[model samples]
Target: MSSEAFRAGDRPVRISVQIAPQHLPIAELRDAAVHAEDLGVDMVMNWDHFYPLSGDPDGLHFEAWTQLAQWAEATERVELGPLVNCNSYRNPNLQADMARTVDHISGGRFVFGTGSGWAQRDYDEYGYPFGTVGSRLDALAHDLPIVRDRWTRLNPAPVRRIPILIGGAGEQKTLRIVAEHADIWHSFVAPDELGRKLDVLQRHAETVGRDVADIEIGNELRGADDAKAAALFDAGVRLFTIGVSGPEIDWAPVERWVRWRDAKNG
Candidate 1:
């Protein structure tokens, strides 16, 4: 699919919720996903991590790809994926294969959101090398093509052209990678920082002969209010996401954001 499709902000606002798989039981997490779908969320997401990012250091946490596979079976309408997958955790070819299988399972609702690995604890515990940021980004820049090439060779193929969402805003390397491979760029930078980073991304896109506007803009609304979200939308962010952590998943914020999205799209 060409990245030059619907500009989400100009068309409809999409709201995705990342239900963090920490401090919660499996049954509850499954139920939460079902409920989110029923509540009309546009997308559902989880993090790729071995331990809790906050709260208890060793709190209960589920792996990402496994849970994502389960979600593909459980929910029917909402698109689902890792909020941002760590590229270093699995081989690029394996990641492509897993993604293709899940895309089939979901009937083409998969969005391949990924990034270079970062969590030191995850690396130490799992025994993957903890390299410098530049090296990690270089690895990601290298692996994305392998993932794409594997996608083409897989039997039965992906249900559709799977969307690649790259998360990060490093102007030099990360943005350049987004320009090259990502259909969606998850710019975690605040609204004020978007223009400059986008300019950098555009420069990179120019070098590759792709349209920079072809990439959709995404942002997190975890610490944002309506005004902030509106500002981001005004600045061209069409994908708004909020993360809810478990064992006490809050539904109110999800509802609020859904309503906000509805209002914006209205």
Candidate 2:
């Protein structure tokens, strides 16, 4: 591992897409992921939900890790992982092992993006307790260290120090956890709202004794027009993600984001 520290805003703008594994044939989903790489996306992501978040309540959907393993083998580049895994679904040790295995399969192009489990329907149908928000966040806070420790103890460790991307913007608990653990912070707040959220994150970083500048800022590209994206870029968000799904996946929006990324990087 490089001794050089991580710094926010140091990297050029990178684009990623979450190919929602729902409402589409598995083959199309797989091809969409490959096509994302072909379109010049920096990362390929999938959701960790049992059912579709859009379209029919019960639609064609696939599990996250299985697809990730397949993606690791299929794509030559572009990092792969869940947009934000539900930590409650698996034991922290198991999560560590799985991520490490995928890291190896991808030849070090894997990111471990996670969050406290949400969506009550998923828990109810899947037999997990739909715990209160506070409890779930507490569980995530507790499990993260175990995951990190498990990574260290694994026989053949990860191909590299897998970047931990924590997706959430809760000022109280989530930001604090991100301060202590995350290499990347994925926030859902719009550009207008992001400044205050980042202020809160900075305070949390101070408490944890890590520089806020060391954690990369990430946001969604869905509703971001070019002007909105430029605002986010000016605000120090280094990564932008857009979500795509279906039997007929549209690459137009994706290509636009890629162009925006290239222009910004240039």
Assess every candidate by TM-score.
0.96, 0.96
Q: What TM-score does candidate 2 get on C-alpha atoms?
A: 0.96
lDDT of 1 by residue, 33-141 (tens): 8999998899999999899998897998999999999999999999999978999999999999999999999999999999997899999999999999999999999
lDDT of 2 by residue, 112-161 (tens): 99999788899999899988989999999999999999999998999999
lDDT of 1: 0.88
Window of ten residues with lowest summed lDDT in model 2:
1-10
Clashes of each: 0, 0
- lDDT for position 65 in model 2: 95
